[model samples]
Target: MQRKVDPEGLAAAAFLAFLATAGLFYVNIMAAIVDGLVSGLAFTDAQAGQVAAVNTYGAAFGAAVSIFTIARFDWRKTSILCLVILVAIDLLSILSTTPMTMIGIRTLHGLVGGLLIGTGMGVIGRTANPDRSFGMLLFVQFGLGGLGVMFLPRLVPLYGVAPLFLSLALFSLVTLCMMPFLPDYPPRSVAAPIKKAGTVQWTPLVLAISALFLFQAANMGLLAYIFRLGTESGLSRDMTSGALGLATWVALAGPLLVMVLGRRFGRFPLLLAGMLLTLGGNALFHWSQFGEVYLLANCATGITWGLVVPYLFGMTAEFDGTGRTAAAASVISKLGLASGPLVASMMLGGGAGFAELINTALAALVLAMLLMLPPAIMLDRSARRPSELLPQGKVTA
Candidate 1:
C-alpha cells in the first residue's frame, strides 16, 4: 500500500526552506553591502565588517531566546511578527549614514532573523525525516542565494545597495504569506519528552555542537571573503559574481546526493569524506592563480558544504529529545558565522590579500577537522550496534 503524503508537512517544510533563504539574505549579500558602505558611506573596511557581523550577532541572541521560549508561542503567529520586524529593519537600514547606526539597525534585524530561523528549524525538526527536511532547507538557501549573487551585483552598479535591502524586505513579506501553512508545534511525541532532560546524554551532544560551530566558523571565514578573493585573483566583477552563483548552484547537489544515498554508507564516512573534500577545496583556492581555477575551487567548497551541514544538524537533533539542543546548536552556528567575517577582516587589515585569507581558512579547516574526529568516532561506534539495541535517535546507517 502506498503511504499518502501529508500536504501540511510538505507545506510546512517549504515555508521553513523559504524562511532559511530570507534569514540568510544578509550574509549572502555581504560583499555587496561592504562595497556599498565603503563607496556610498565612506566607511573603512573595519566599519563595513562590523555592519556585516552585527546581524549574525543579533541572530545568535535571538536563537538563544527562542531556545527557551519557543514552546510558549504559536509558531505561525511568531513567524509573522518576526517577518514584519525584519522587513521594517531592512528598510530602516538604508537610512544609516554612520557605522554605529548601521550596526544598531542590523543587530535588530539579526535578532528577528534568528527567531525566524529557530522557529523554522523547530517545525522541520519534528518531521519524520529531518535529514531530508534540512536538505530541502539548504537547497532553497543555496538556490536563492545563487540567484541573488548572480543578479545583485548587476543591480548594485545601477541602483546601489538600498534596492538590495528593499528586495530582501519584499522577499520576507512574501514569506509571511506562507506562515499559515506551518505547524503550530512539534508532534506530541517529540515535545512531551521535555521532562527527561536529566537523562539526556551530554558528551556526544556537546561534541556534535562544537563540531558544528567550528565547521561553520571555518567555512564562513573563507566564504565571507570569496568575492574579494575572486577580484584579487584578477576576475572582473561580473566574472566573480558568476563564479559565486555557479558555485552556489553546484552546492545544491550535495544535499540532493545525501537524500538519494539516505544513510546507505553511514554518517561517519560521509562526514569524514566531506571534511577532507573541504580541505582539498581550500587548498585549491590557496594555490589557484587563474580565474577558472578559482571558480572551480568555489564549486568544490560549495559541494563540501552541501554534503555535510544536514548531517551535523541531524546529529544534534538525534542527541536531544526536546529539541532545545538543536536550537542551541543553531545559536552556536550563527555565532561562528558572525565571527568569520570579523576574523577575516582582521586578517585582511590594511591591504592584505588572498594569501592571508587562504592561510586563515586553512588554519580554521584544520581546527574543524580536529573537532569533528570525536563525533565521527562516536557515530562509527553507534553504527556498529544492533538496530534493536540502539538508542532511539542514535541509529546511523
Candidate 2:
C-alpha cells in the first residue's frame, strides 16, 4: 500500500486547507471595496453581477481542468502555485480601474481558487477512510474560511479599500506560509502500478452537485444585495452591518449544532429545516421594519449557510466516494453559485427593482427546496442501510 498518511497530520493538513479557504473569503471584502470603486463603469446591475461572477466562472472552468490534470500533477505543487497566483492577482488589482478589469482578475483568481480548493478536497479523500464524513471536516474549513467573510464588513471602516486589499493579501500570505506542512494528495491508486487515479460515478454526483448549486445560488443571490435590502427597509448601515457581523460570528456554531442533531435525525431533515429558516429570513428581509428583524435574518443566514456549506460537500461524497468527487462538487458550485448573483441581479432584465430581486431569490429558494426532494427521497431509501454504500470507518473526531 502507498504510505497511509498519518491521521493527526492529515487533520492538520485539512485545517490548513481551511485557513487558505477562509483567506479567500476574507479577501472578498476587498473585492467588494474594489467593486464599489469600479461599478461606475458598469452600465447595468447585470454587468456588475457578472463581474462578481467571474470567480465562479473561472472556478468552474478550472474544475474541468482539475478533472484531467489532477491525475498527472502533484496536488502539492498545484496548491503552492495557486496560492502564489492568488497574491499576484490581488497585487494586479492596483492597476485595474474598470468592470472588465475586475472580471478578468476575478476570473484568474477563481481559476487559481479552483485549483487550490479542489486540491484540498482531493487530499481529504486520499487521507481518510471510507466512513469518515466530509461534512464536519468541510465545516471546519468553511468556518475558518468564513472568518474572512464574516469580518469583511468590519474592514471597510478600519482600513478603507486599498488597505483592505493589503489586509486580504496578508491573509493569503499566511496561508501560503502554512502550505508546506500539508499532505500530498495524489489520486493515483496504490493497488495497481500504472493505475488510474480515483474517479467518481457521474449520475448521482451530478444530482448532488445540482443540489449544492441551487442551494448556493439561492443564498448568494440574496446576500449579494442584502445590505441594500436592509437599507431600503429603513435599517441603518450601522444596524445592518452589526447584523452581518453577528451572523459571521455565530455561523461557526450552526454546523456543530447540526452535527449533533445529525446523530439522531438524518442529514436531509436538517437541510430542510435550514432551507425553511432561510426562506423565512428572506421573507423578513422583504417586510422586516425593525433592526431586531434584520438581526434575526443574520442569524438565519448564518445558520443556514453554515449548515449547507459543509453539508453540501458531504452530500457529494455520499453520492460518490472518489477523488474526483471534489471536482464534481466544485463544478456545481461554479455554475450555480457563480451565476446566481448575476442572474438575480438582473431579475427584471435591466429593470430589476428591490421587490423583484426579493421575488427572484424567493423563487430560487423554492426551487432549491424542490431540488432536494428527489435526492432526499433516494437517500432515504438507503438511509436504513447507509452503511452499505459508504462503508465504515471512525466518523467523528
Candidate 3:
C-alpha cells in the first residue's frame, strides 16, 4: 500500500530538525539572558524563576496543541505559522523591558517552541532510520544547540536576548527555504496500528518512554544550571561557555558510534551505554573543582546525549508510531525543560549550594537506571540484540 521511503525527504527532515532545535537552544541562551534582564529589573530570583516557568507552561500547553493542531491543520501551514509566531515573539523579547512582558513573550515562546519541536521532530522520525533516527535526531539537537549557543552569546551583547531570538526568526526563515523540498506528510508506507492493539501490549515502549523522561530530566537539568554552578565555583563565563559550546560538541561521539553499531544492536543497550556515559560525566563534574574537569564532564555528557535522545525517539516511533509518538515525547520534554530551573531553584538557592542539586541528580539517575531493568527482562532477545536493532523504526504494516 505504501511506496519506497525517500532518502532526500529524510535528509530534509534532519535539517529541519536542526533548525527547530536551534530555536530551542536560542531559548536556552535566552534563559541566561532572562536572568540578566531580571537582575536589571530588580525582580527577585523567585520572580525570575516564574518567568522561566511561563515558557514551560506555554510549551506543555503547546505540545498538547500539536496533537490536535497537526490533525486539524496541514503540517505545512502549521509549520509556517509557528515560525511566524516565533519570529514576532523573539523580536518582542528584545523589546521587553519588564517581567510581565518577558513572561508574556516566553509564554508565547513555550507554546510555539513546543509545536516546532513536536512537529519538526515527528517529520524527521517518520522519514529517517528508526534505530539510528533516535541518535540522529539528538545529533541534530546538539548541532543546532551548539550553533545557537555560539551565536546567541555573541549576539546578546550586540542586540540583547530578544534580538538574539530575532536571529532565531531568521533561522526559522531557513526552515521555509527547505519547505518546498521537505515532505509534507508521512509516507503512506509508514504502517501505523490504528486500534492501539486491543490485545497488543506496549510495556517495552512504555518503559522506554519513562526512561526518556528520566534521562532528559537529568540531562537538561545539568545543561540549564551547570553554567551557573561552574561560575559560582570560580569558573569564568567564557570557561563555562566553552564547556557548553565546545565540550558539549563532544557528544557527537555517541551517535557516530551508533551509526556503526546501530545496525548491529538494540536501542536499549545503546541507551544504557549512554546512561553510563552521562553518569560518568556528572560524576566527573561533581568531583573536580577545575574548569577542565567540568569541560571533560560536558564532553562525556555531549556524546551520550547525542545517542540516547535519538535512540529514545526512534524506539518510541517503533513501539507506538511517529506522528503522535513525537507528540507524546513533548510532554516529558516540556516538563524537563521547565523542571531544570525549578529544580535548581529549590536545590541550590538559599545558600543550600550545589550539593543538593548534584546529589539529587545522581540519585534520580540511579532511579532512572533502576527503571531500565524491567525492559531488559521483558523485551525479546532480538529486540535486545545489537545486530538486530534497525537504525530506523517506522511502522511496517
Best TM-score among the predictions, by candidate number: 1
Cα error, candidate 3, residue 361 (Å): 1.0
Q: What is the RMSD of candidate 1?
A: 4.1
List runs of model 2 lying over 4 Å from the truth: 1-15, 19-47, 129-160, 183-208, 309-312, 316-326, 385-397
lDDT of 1 at 362: 76
lDDT of 3 at 230: 67
Give me the candidate number with maximum lDDT.
1
In order, the Cα lDDT scores of the candidates are 0.74, 0.61, 0.62
Give the candidates in order of lDDT, highest first.
1, 3, 2
Expressed as tens digits, the lDDT of each residue in 314-391 for candidate 3 is 555555533445557668666766766666655544555665677777777777767764554444354555334333
Clashing pairs for predicted structure model 1, backbone only: none
Greater TM-score among 2 and 3 belongs to 3
Clashes of each: 0, 2, 19
RMSD in Å for model 3: 5.2
Global fold similarity of model 2 (TM-score): 0.79
